[model samples]
Target chain A: MNTFFTIVAGFLLVNIAAGLVRVYLGPTPADRMLSAQLFGTTGVAILLLLSQALSTPALVDAALVLGLLAAVAVVAFVMRVPQSEREADEE
Target chain B: MSFAGLVLDGLLALSLPVLAWRALSARDLYRAVILFITFGVILALAWARLGAPDIALAEAAIGAGITGALLLNTVGGLSRKNDKDDERPDEPTDRVGRPWRTRLAVTVPVTILAGGLAWAVLSFPAPVVDMPSLVGEAVAEGEVSHPVTAVLLDYRSYDTFLEIGVLLLAALCVWSLGLSAVRSTAPEAVSGSPVLAGFVRLLAPAMVVSGVYLLWAGTSQPGGAFQAGAVLGALGVVMVLTGLLVPSLGRGGVVRAGLALGFAVFLLVGVVSMLATGGFLAYPEGFEYGLILAIEFFLTFSIALTLTALFTTVPPREKGGGA
Candidate 1:
């Protein structure tokens, strides 16, 4: 069952690669943005899986920091964008 | 190597690259961002499975949290003026074809590197000198019982100090990018989403409790101030993002103080110890828990604040460009 989940999670990493392609090929900036986020989320999943499999305590810290940093990045980016641009770019 | 763990791991492994691919392939950036955040959460879970709690915490906090915020900000900025240019390519002919050379360049190297790494990680036996064990023994011998925490804040305090500096440096780099010029309207604020606000309200107290639990529990288990503080900081981030809490330059003295508090207290305690006991970071014998708790609390606050600030961009004031 754990291996199953690991496999599932591992598959998700491929999705991340797809997301990366989207990021590069995305028609709009929003698309690229979405792709980047997808990568971040998937990266987290990988860490979670590794933590359990490896049973090494250090990885937990890495995961926690990753989550925290991801949150901060989103907040800061949202805050920095101009209102007018946000309005215009909502598509 | 249990059947269950193997299957779960396989599933996770399978899903990751797909999500990455879809994230990059998606037409809308918002979808990608959401996907990425979800990916981060999953990664945390994976870390837990691997038995590396510290790395898990860092991955969740830094990899998922901070990276997501930064990407979103960049997207927002680009959407404003560059939308038209960024939208569909300007190919004169039919659909644009992905460059084969680019594909080969990316694929060949990644395949080789990943294969080599996977094989290496799988084949390597556990090293004889396990630092965690040595650290654990040291902690047991010393007043600090938690090896990880001791490694982070005591035995290896220097690393902790430098890591904090790295965090500051990252914040400075982001600040240098001129994010402050953007107005703080907080269009992404939680006020727009009733459900989100409600969720935040519900989660606030629980998060606080968990943060505390993680801190105190670190002495015996896989919890500590850094993990707890990051979690608590996350709560703050959530509130700020949702508009439940507004940030301002005027009265952030408390926040500023919190930002500076941890390292300050640590350094002060270190200096004081040197003056009193003739060594650095040496808790004055019997006052171990007291000093450790004090430093932990301050560090927690500072970490929370610094993390928050790192996400909150400020415009530079009259400094020469590109310093």
Candidate 2:
């Protein structure tokens, strides 16, 4: 069962890696920021799966911390790099 | 390890370098910062696979969350400065003007140095010493059930004490730089959206509870003061970004005291222990857990404040115009 969970987690991680291509090829900062957000959600899933696979309940706490704080970077991005500024940079 | 575990580890290890290379080579500063956050997450997973949950927690919280927020803020600040200076916002201003020959000259020795270090690490022999056994024997007298916490707060607390001092020193250095004028330009305050406002309101309490729980759990599990501090610091970053807590408020007496509280309490505890027990940082017998928890509580507050202040570089104005 643990092995099965680890395998599923590995597949999710591969999906995350695929998502990075969008960030790399982004035409806008917003696109890249979205990719980072995807990473945050995927990371929480990976941590959760690993916690179960590894039988170390402490990892769940790490997941909780990540989920709670991951959106912060996006908030910073929005506040500091406004939509107009990103659009302006494109020109 | 099972086949699945091995494959998972292999994929994680392989992705780390790829993410790191892309982060470094990305032309867009924002892309680079985002990629760096992804790299940090991968690295945290690697730490977990290596059986260091404490390190994994800290890496995720501080390495990814806090550092990503700081980088995003910095990139924003730089672009804003560029706008004021009438420079191209897309172009990096801090690019070095060294010739390719100079770059090659630096790269050669750096490569050789890195190779030598890698070789040394790969060649290291398994320690013949029974350090774990020694620690195990000694840890019984300590209050904490976790070995890492026992080592950090009881066995080798002087190092921890000095680390808190270092954090305090860093905050002091940033304070000395004086407030930058650019902070006043922070987006129209509170984002003009009710959803974000409600989110911040809801998340703030949850983050506080998580931070406190992580600190308390450190006595027996993989959480600790540093991890808890980073969580709280990230909370502060989120609140500040939402305009809920202005940077200038950090200049107030209460905030300043909070910033100093960790180092002060730790130092006081050490000195008192030295004077009374003839050993620095030696908790009185039967009260080790209580003292360590007390120290950790104050340390968490100070760390959170210091990290928040470090990111918010502007002092609060007397007029209180901004949020």
Candidate 3:
């Protein structure tokens, strides 16, 4: 059980590391921005898994906070960074 | 720990330095900032692995989330201003022109100093005193149920007091160097995005609820004023960037008062308590919990206001940079 959760979390981290390649080669800045979106989802998943594995409910609250604030960077990216190689004004 | 757990911890430990190196060594500023955000996310996980959930929340919110937004905002502004040069991959954001010998000259002594510090830390002995147990007993006597809360508020409140003061001072410094006007307009702002604005409006409630929950949870759990404040401040940044807020608003009396409220309330409480207890920030025998909660409450507001003000640092509107 705990071991299962830990491994899952570790794989998620590895998943993020794998996603780093896309960040480098994603051409447009908007495509690069998806890395942050990946982090928000994967980071919350990791935190939630760790909370269950470690039996510390505090980490759930951390996950909640992470889930809530996850889109902030995306919003900032959309609102601030003007579309350079545009697909749809801010693609 | 099991082998799987060990592997997970190992991945976290190894990746931190690797990610940091990548962020620093990246040629493009945008990539560097993006990598830095990724590093912050992993850093929060590391803190959680160390069983520090409070720091984890703060790091996730402030270090990873809001800081990423702020950095991205700066990157956006820089890219907008310098359209020609930065877009090119060949032009590095910064070029280290120093010769290899000069770099080696600085690197050698710094590496030795870092090694010496690491060695000293590794060799350090366990404490003669059992500080955790002592704190446990003291926390039992205090109003706050949580050990971290007790230490932060009842046991060593002066640090929290001075921290709020420093926050105020930081806001002051940023205000003095007014920088709000130059990059106020955004493509989204000019071409109105009601969808984003509606999304933000929807987010406001969740942020307020979570922030209050963090502050309230601090009495018994890992959530605290700093974490709560950070959530609110991030909300502030979102609103400010959306043009729902005037960039020059931080200079207004209402916002300044909100900024000062935390420090003022804290000092007033401290002075009142000191007059009775003969020590600043000392609470009455049974009134400790209430005092700590009140202080935490105000500190949250002050911190939130200060952080938002720092983010909203445009040149004063009167001399507005023609935005």
Candidate 4:
């Protein structure tokens, strides 16, 4: 079961690697930024699996903190990017 | 290790460099910043794989989360300067357009310097003192059950003291450089956003609770003051961003007191310890737990204040409104 969890975590890492494609081929900054959000979810999944695999429950707290702060970049992006700049990306 | 675990380790080791290279070489600033955040997440996982949960916790909060926000904020500022371009390039053309000879001149030395540092780290000699065994034995006698926390607060407390002092110093410097036009002093666009207000309202209590939990867990687990402080510090950042707290808060006497509380207390403790125990930073016999906890409690708050204060700028002090 530990091995199974470990392998599953590896696959999720691959998913994160794949998501980086959107970051590279971004049509907009928001599209690029969402890849990080993808990690926030997928990375938490990976951490949970690795905690079970490695028998270290502390990583779950790391996961909790990661999940909690995950939206910070998006919030910052929304706040910092001016309305004109944000709208300009659409048209 | 099993084949599955081995493969997982290999994949993580391989991808870290790939992510770093991609982040560094990317032409688009926004993409690079996003990739940087991605890299931080993987790096935290790598730390976890290496069995360093404390580092993993700090990296998850500071490396991935806080850094991403800061870099994104900076990129926003950078892009706001760059008008009429869909993709803003990060590097000045002068570096890219420099003659290959000049580029080589810079690159060769940097590569050598990096190699030398790597070699020095790799070639580190075993300590004559047998630090781990010594720490393990000493920690058994100490009140702090966790070796890492014991070492941080008891064994090498001088180092921790200086580090906290540095955080306090950074806040001082930033406050001194107040009224910098680079700061956003006007009304916040973020404060008016209902989504953010709702999110922060939900999250702030969790952060506060977790921060205290981390500090409490330091006695027996990988969590400690730094991790707790990072969470609290990030909370302050969110408050400032949402305009729940004004930037001018950093300049206030109360904030300055909060910022210096840990440093001053740590120093006083050391001085009193020196006189009381005949050794600086030496906890009194059988009172180790209480002393460490007291220091950690104050250190946590000051660290949080310092982190938040560094990111803030304030209007210049008027006459009689001095630090």
* Candidate 2 lDDT tens digits, A2-44: 9999999999889888999888777788888888889989998
Choose the strongest candidate by TM-score: 3
Which residue pairs collide in model 4, if any?
none
lDDT of each: 0.62, 0.82, 0.81, 0.80
On lDDT, the leading prediction is 2
Candidate 3 CAPRI-style tier:
medium
Model 3 lDDT per residue over B20-122, tens place: 9888888666777788888988999998888989888888988788888878776655543333334554345347477889889989999999999999999
Ranking by lDDT: 2, 3, 4, 1
Question: Residue B102 of model 4: what lDDT?
Answer: 88
True contacts kept of 1: 0.61
Model 1 per-residue lDDT tens digits across residues B83-195:
35465432222245668897799889999999999999999998989876787677777776766777777777767876766765665576567665333445555667576
Candidate 2 runs further than 4 Å off: A88-91, B80-101, B123-125, B181-191, B314-323
Native A-B contacts reproduced, model 2: 0.63
Q: Select the stronger candidate by TM-score from 3 and 4.
A: 3
TM-score of chain B of 1: 0.73
Candidate 4 wrongly placed segments (more than 4 Å): A87-91, B79-89, B92-95, B179-192, B247-250, B314-323
Supply the DockQ value of model 4.
Answer: 0.54
lDDT of 4 by residue, B1-323 (tens): 99988988998999999998888887667778888889889999999999988888889988888888877766555544333354434553544667889889999999999999999999999878998899999988878999999999999999999999888877777667654323432245455657777888898999999899999998998888888888888888777666666646646688878999999999989999999999999988988898899999999999888877655643432343221
**RMSD, one per candidate, in order:** 7.5, 3.7, 3.5, 4.6
For model 1, what is the alpha-carbon lDDT of residue B229?
74
lDDT of 2 by residue, B178-204 (tens): 766335244555656777778888888
Q: List runs of model 1 lying over 4 Å from the truth.
A: A1-91, B11-35, B86-130, B181-193, B247-254, B314-323
